[model samples]
Target: MMRPRRLPPCLAAAILTATAVAVLLLSASSPGGALLASRQSPPPPARPEWGPGRPPSFAYWISGTRNDSRRALRLLRAVYHPRNRYLLHLDAAADAAEREAMAEAVRGEPAWREFRNVDVVGEAYAVDRTGSSALAAALHGAAVLLKVGAHWDWLVTLSAADYPLVTQDDLLYAFSSVPRDLNFIDHTSDLGWKEHERFEKLIVDPSLYMDRNTEPFPGTGTRPMPDAFKIFTGSPWVILSRNFTEHCVYGLDNLPRKLLMYFANTAYSVEAYFQTLICNSSDFRNTTVNGDLRYFVWDDPPGLDPLVLNESHFQNMVNSSTAFARRFEEDAPVLKKIDDELLNGSSVQLVPGIWCSNLSKEQGRMDVESCLKWGDINTVRPGHSGEKLWRYISTISQTRGCS
Candidate 1:
């Protein structure tokens, strides 16, 4: 092809500068660009005044995948509290429309809108529950919560399949006396059969690279265990203190990053990453409480996932004294039972709490209208369930020592 005519040096410089300015303006107008600019701005405003003796707030990262939008919303409503922060994530399996719908639903809630405490992960990536991607997603959620919620004392990760056995009022009352630094994580140093099959075995998750979800496949060669830090594994579901979460996310020490790299190729790293990190770190080791504070019923020979909970499991779940439970079929009747007996409200309602009472009075609405009345959000009034939870936590804390 014939050579194109070249512009003069000064003219070309002017054209390039003009193009750069145009591109900058375009980016500054886009939503992603606006978000980037906002991050560079000052941190979110200081936390609202938590009155004396107020219960500590929790930052919840509720994640789900395809077809889990409604279920996740229900779970959010069940656990909703004006003081706590909520971050919802529907993974890559969920289409953009579903994610938007979730965001819209959250925005539609009067309390959620008024408090402005709930957020939806707008840009989501693939996550393989069986592989390191799950760990990555959890960390991402933690990081986001740390950024968005400056006042929350704890970080709790939940999936759509999980549901609360106790209301927010009951949970807050139960935890009101708890030390803010304690971590409720079910962990054990004993690897048992998992040492060979999980720790030593190598696997790669396709979801990390592929757009679609796929199971992780094992490699032919196995690797040796690490001597640097002992491996600890447990339930992936955990309630982590802000202090420990900050350690994992910010990595003041190299331990968290080092273990993260080591677990990238390991099977089900989500189960072990936080456990190992907390147990290995001197600052956080002593803070572990050795219980996830969640209840579940597993098969006689426990399978990969816990059994789906239903109406029959209601009594046992209630007696377990756990704040949360898992693996419930969507809209299971047991959830309704928990709502009626423990929550004192319907599933769609926002678990009546002190905040609910206050919000009702502020709006001049009837005291009984919509479960929102005026009471002190600072103080917690525990019920029989809260008493049970407190006793359970106290018993566990006394028996379990972090080594």
Candidate 2:
């Protein structure tokens, strides 16, 4: 092989300086990296436009498993917005090819590429929704979102079975007037049957320690209910505030950690982890809104999951006034109905918003283009759905208090 040529002393110095600056910028861009750099460097500049009177952005963690990539993509498109950030995760149950395909799909969208607001979890972990591994996966997602350093006010978690009932514009407009610190979580202090089935019995999730997906098995011993903190349970889906998420992820208090340990051996910890944390904490208890902002219909004697939404549920779903509804079958007709009536677009097309209108006008096209014109992302225009949501929230807030 031929010897490589050496650069001149001046050129080498310039190259080194450029590389150092690039490294600094990369480190400062991430939330976790910025926290480390703060001890040594000046603080990063703030985005004043994202302050008060602006439409707040949401960081969505949309997760799925094997054969759910297409459904996840549909959900992402339904909820997609230039202002919001999205993280799509495929658990270890999905093969590497599936994960790669999901990433490619996200990158294939011109608007997604333009905004650079979507990401895929490259490293997959086994997740059993019936066990604590699901809770771990959710916490991991929240941590990644925080590290990504997005300027978002809330963190919403969704699954492939979920679909948006309202457009992004409608959701943003309805939330604009809401308090930034409030967390929309459905919870009740009464454990009822879950007290014995979920909390008292001990179980071990193989997903936590195994390389392959496995079901949770019961352990020999049982544990008593803790008198130290009260337990609350509710829907696994949640819309959490930034402050509350930070508290769970990085709070100095020991309550979050203690609960994490307690729930590690519990079944379906996702339903109880955040609920117990918020209800037990003095600081965040007052911020609970007692609603998850999601619509779900369970059977008379509810089974493990909610009934899969179909066309028959369309009218009731529309009247629910919730931003999202869950447990939709793949390519269900109800999703198409919601897309046509509420979202103003097809399932494959993004829900049209002010940004789409701006892009259409700027490009001088009669219809919106696939490529977006990023307008004032901080602004929002509410529609009839927004009015309905505002009314629903107002009515609930007046009567519901944190238990």
Candidate 3:
């Protein structure tokens, strides 16, 4: 989001980090994790009871590079919910101390500690957005989420620059009714210009091999598009179903691995790999929803990146009613505005929701860092934004394109 723009694919991590995170799983070893790995519905994490139509929980893979720990933490707090699971990561460019600091901040929260739904990747390797390593990093994050906590329904990827436009409750409430098998990925069979620049561009991501001093753009070469399968490209950001992520990771079918090998040499593979895989796979093609549910303000000519949002974009952003927006400046006034105007909470404090019920009830509650007490996490009290988001998702879910 800052420099070396993040290739946002809602779920992912690094192989190097996988070796080190062997012991940091937030939830204890349980059969639920195994069930999730086997692509079945795992028992929900031990939390409060609820009535019918309980909202779906998300597994967020929030990644950042060097010097982004605070920003990542800020984003985590903004989206935190007892219902969801979080895996925070500072990539290889970031040092051990920064990773430790990020972990410490996550531990600083009482609700997170009580629920044990958050974790920080202790080890990392290079991740270059312009190369296939970006895709690798995302895959790694998905691997970790699948490994550690398997209770979440959907996998959401967030960069430090991204902030939620809708509160966690709103997003969850909206998604509560959607079919679990449906995947929300913006896609098009029309490659147009990307067919040459993206699919045909053969490149080597140095980060895949090295540990530091990542070269921004990898060297490139030209090759014809793959004849084996049709290629699809669209917004890198996606809200992937757990089954889809498992399909990507477990590789029960050879298509995922075949595409992985093919895209490993292609530049910005994160933008196309998932799209191509889902669209090509017979089982998942019809489940595609043709929208990523992210709000962005594009440049006049629409350059490689979206325009950096600021105060001027607030009303328009709210009008869009998307779940998240990207590329905000660190601690920008607009963030404060979103916290106050939209979220109905403080920028520094967790978004007020049913889960944080006891925080408001307690007398002289001094700890601002943690929600000392909690309420029924399964109970969802959706705000107006939540209702609008539900409608937005319902309308978009009817669109077609993955085939």
Ranking by lDDT: 2, 3, 1
Question: What are the runs in model 3 whose C-alpha is more than 4 Å off?
Answer: 1-52, 216-221, 358-369
Error of 1 at 147 (Å): 0.2
Off by over 4 Å in 1: 1-48, 358-375
TM-score winner = 3
TM-scores for all predictions? 0.84, 0.85, 0.87
lDDT (Cα, tens digit) per residue for candidate 2, span 1-403: 1111211112112122222211111111122211122222212222226778788889999999999999998898889887788878877789989877777777666666556577777666778989888887777677667666458899999999999888888898888877888889999988899999999999998888776678999998889999999999999999999999888777778787788788888999999999999988889888889899898989989998998889888889898889999888898887878877888777566777776654322235455434434444556777899989988876665543457
How many steric clashes between backbone atoms does each model show? Answer: 5, 0, 7
Candidate 2: minimum summed lDDT over ten consecutive residues — where?
Answer: 20-29
* CA lDDT for candidate 1: 0.74
lDDT of 3 at 23: 31
2 against 3, candidate with superior TM-score? 3
- Candidate that beats the other on TM-score, 1 or 2, i.e. the better one: 2
Q: Kindly list the per-residue Cα lDDT of model 1 for residues 1-403, writing each as its tens digit.
A: 1111211112112122222211001111123212223223322233345634778889998999999999998898888876788878877889989887777766555556546677777665778899877887787777666766688888999999998877787787777777888999999999999999999999988777676667899878998889999999999999999888887777656787788778888899989988999988888788889999888888989898998888888888888889899889888888878777877766565677766543222244533223333345565677788788888887776654455
RMSD to true structure for each model, in Å: 10.8, 10.8, 7.7
